[model samples]
Target: MYGCEWDDETGATNGFFQDGYDGEDFLSLDLKEMRWISPVQQGFLTVQKWNKDTANTEYQKQYLSTVCIEWLQKYLQYGKSSLQKTVPPHVSLLQKSSSSPVTCHATGFYPNEVKISWMRNDEDHDEDVDLGELLPNEDGTFQKMSTIRVTPDELKKNQFSCVVEHQGKTIKKTLTDDSLPIGIIVGALAAVVLLVVISVVVFKVYQKKKGFKPVSASDDGSNSSAHSDAKA
Candidate 1:
């Protein structure tokens, strides 16, 4: 492999050309000395032959130092738009249940650099906190999750929040009762109500199909006896 390195801040440049054999260093080009160096015995003859070729060595040096750097700069210029693009993260607080840890989840961010932490009463809190790994999204974005274990009472007595830092922006999510998985409870209640309504409908349909009539409590015995006399 051969390449050039450029330091934009320091305006420093360096180049190297190295060859390996069977995962071991075989030969390397020394730009400063304008010679080939061989660390292994098998490459000694090859290095000697290469070092004697002054014209080829000069060309190699020129390509590594000048031409390679020019191509690298051109590539960087051509892809600057995508290389420097930044997308802010969308963060949320999630929990499986009241007894579970609260996770600060951030997703749909670009560049994959992010920081997640917990804060209590406006101060950093790291106890019982677990930081998750940065993961990739299907849309070329990134995601991460950080969780904190705290009791319900602690949440009520103090202010707890999840903070995420990405793309020079800060996002915070405060722990609230609304953040709890109350939707699960509401969904369960709704299911029970639906079941009761279905049962009532089914029972009414069965009664109608069986020709069953409901007896009223207001019917008198005299009315019943007159009906019987008429029948006689």
Candidate 2:
């Protein structure tokens, strides 16, 4: 009979080979029945190991790919909705062209993390730009706003630009100047001012008319006669 154990704890597999060994550490060919079962069991074990290894490899690949996609999305700021880890920052320029110095305000920026600045040509804007509040995103990033005072000349040559920097990436957007038809706006305002002035004058004239009273000479005859007597 052959002695064999199928588990390490019980010394099953090795036990069979150990007890079945001949005078040397080798087994004799006459121990066919005992050795035969080993080949079958080894085949089964090999198949099981191959399946487990394949499954583990596939899982690792999938996990690594997912991690890579997430890492890229944090900086890319654009792409698949599922991979949209960061919201792209937006900016708008607000201008009051009629004011002495045209006012430019910029709003909307994201990861909520960034710095905003204004430039004239390419110089640092000192008093020209007023930085506003830095808002936060739900994801813990930051958003900041800023405004700049631009002169007519700057607006004309398109010398002003708004710059945003985040995570070492810089984005610059050229400022746009929307022409306000001064003639039309001023004409309309003038028409209104004229209307107001005319209304005021008319009101005054109406009050004068309401307060005026005609005096009759016949009612003042006694006073006039006394004045004539004194003169005489």
All candidates: TM-score: 0.62, 0.35
Runs of candidate 1 exceeding 4 Å displacement:
1-4, 14-62, 182-232
For each candidate, C-alpha RMSD in Å?
Answer: 12.3, 27.0
What does the lDDT read for residue 179 in candidate 2?
57
* Model 2 TM-score, all chains together: 0.35
After TM-score superposition, the amount by which residue 125's alpha carbon in candidate 2 deviates from its true location, in angstroms, is 2.1
**Candidate 1 lDDT over residue span 40-87, tens digit each:** 999999998998999999999999889988988888889889876899
Q: Which stretch of 10 consecutive residues in model 1 shows the poorest summed lDDT?
A: 177-186
Q: Report the poorest 10 consecutive residues by lDDT, candidate 2.
A: 27-36
In model 2, state the lDDT of residue 73: 43
- The numbered model that scores best in TM-score is 1
TM-score of 1: 0.62
- Record all residue pairs in model 1 with backbone atoms less than 3 Å apart, i.e. clashing: none
